[model samples]
Target: MHRRRRTAVVVTSALLLSVPLLAACGNEARPGAAAVVGGERIEVGAVQSKVKAVRVAQERSPQAEQLVKDSGQLTRAKLYDLIVARVVEKAAEDAGVSVTRKEVQTGRAQLVGQAGGEEQLAAMYLQQRGIAPGQLEDVVRRDVLVGKLAEAIGATNGQEGQQKLNAAFSAAAATLDIDVNPRFGTWSDQDLALGEYKAPWITQVTQSQGAPVSGA
Candidate 1:
């Protein structure tokens, strides 16, 4: 009886010691399972997946497709959007701005309007964007809360407010230290045939035509 009791005690102690090691191993196995922002752990995979989905949507656009082919702007834009969203979310939390169901409903209504109505919007988002009707409400709620927090941080209706907001945005953008992967995001208009061109012969041609040149 004494030997059995001692053996049980030893086994219990061993199991207790293994628990922490097991937990550490589990965490190591899932590298991106959690995202640590300001010491808070949010689900990293969830946010990353959402960002990818948005990128996929942008990829479907003709201009976006061409841009992505020349420069990886799609991925960079997605990263930028996520970083900005996370910052805005943090700001909202700091400002104590809360999103309510009613506010989410209002946001959903606005999105529906942009989508051209509830039925059509639902089909379009579901089929093309792979976003469910319910999920859109959550997205809208977060956006609305962020907007409200921004307004609160920099009041909504004055020149001072506008300046404050611009300053705040600039500061936020600076702090993000976004390192855009050039292969995915950098492209010159010359490479894409999208910017203006100087025509040296045009000036002489117009002069020969006797066209009135203002201030000439």
Candidate 2:
């Protein structure tokens, strides 16, 4: 019985030692990075900066409390957005697609018009997409890229076409060799997702002119 008790203590000690060692190894592997995509580090600091921007914008809004409550996972969401941006860029490059600054400006202008003004557009984006007013340009640029990518790949305006677009993004994501910090979550190259966050759907190129073509 004494021998069995000694063995149990030894086993328990081993288990306890392993936990910190594993954590240390994880931190060492991706130190300071929220994720690494295609050998490029998405720094944790960058994610925090984005979250800060959104928080500042949310605070200025009348629905500040609700906005904060809704975006409890703001850090992860921002990181996910950064990852998706790289994924979209990769897919666009693979398809010989690109978005000009002028295109982004035009797209933003159209969205502002649709939303009825700058403030309304900002509010709409903040409420629906968790984007800060300052960050809206980047999001619009990504949308333009997705639209052009859809066009370049011959993806149509239907479920079948959406699937095809998704496959393209998934392929791009796989090639990136994305390695996310385990604290945030796992990266799914197959689903183009970060943990519980499923990849955003691709908007049809045909619909880009009617409204803001959104994707993560």
Candidate 3:
């Protein structure tokens, strides 16, 4: 009877020691999701699919080749932006703020009128920016949400509101558990944005007067 009791204690201790290992293994095992936001898995396959769609959308531009050579940049950066933007959208909802299609359209129309009308806006987005009208609309949607959320939170005027909105989003993002697949890089808490990770390195090393510098 004593032998069985001793064996049971040994097994329990083994499991207790293994618990931390299991946590590390859990992180390693999830090599697939591009990001895990809150509890939702933003799948790598879906991100790539969206990337492809964005590239296809830009194909209508006369400058498509130059845009493609620019590293399919919109696909790369916007996917990260979209992920972070979704987090902001959640925060906006919690703040009881929302934007509608009409708001986006009305705001966009005002901008169009300000920019000297529709043709000018088209030239700005498509020709100069190489962004499709549909893509611009997506940008408008996020912009409207941010503006509305900022206003609701008393951040309604000038750059002050925008700064306040940034603070609010940063606070919201900090409260969540977020992970990014190494391939897609890291999420920046400072910017509440995602970008490819770069290992920190000294861009320039300077020596004060009479100081010696050595390299291996």
The best candidate by TM-score is 2
Query: Lowest-lDDT window of 10 residues in candidate 3?
Result: 8-17
Q: How far does residue 129 in candidate 2 sit from its true spot (Å)?
A: 0.2
| Backbone clashes counted, model 2 | 0
Sort by TM-score, best first.
2, 3, 1
lDDT of 3 by residue, 1-216 (tens): 111111100000000000010111125667556677777777666655655655675576566787555533443354455565666677687798887788778656755765677766654555433344656676556655665565568664445645665677767676666776655556776565455322211011222322211111
Clashes of 1: 3
Model 1, TM vs. native: 0.44
Better of 1 and 3 by TM-score: 3
lDDT of 1 by residue, 29-137 (tens): 3354332333433344454565456446446644455433432332232233344455556555656777678766755665566567877665454343334354455
Candidate 1 lDDT score at position 126:
37
Which regions of candidate 1 are displaced past 4 Å?
A: 1-36, 40-48, 51-71, 118-138, 166-216
Where's the lowest-lDDT run of ten residues in candidate 1? 8-17
Taken over the whole model, the C-alpha lDDT of each candidate is 0.38, 0.70, 0.51
Instruction: Give the C-alpha miss distance for residue 7 in model 3, angstroms.
Output: 70
RMSD per candidate (Å) reads 23.6, 16.3, 20.6
Model 2: residues >4 Å from true position, as ranges? 1-25, 199-209, 213-216
Minimum summed lDDT over a 10-residue window in model 2 is located at: 8-17
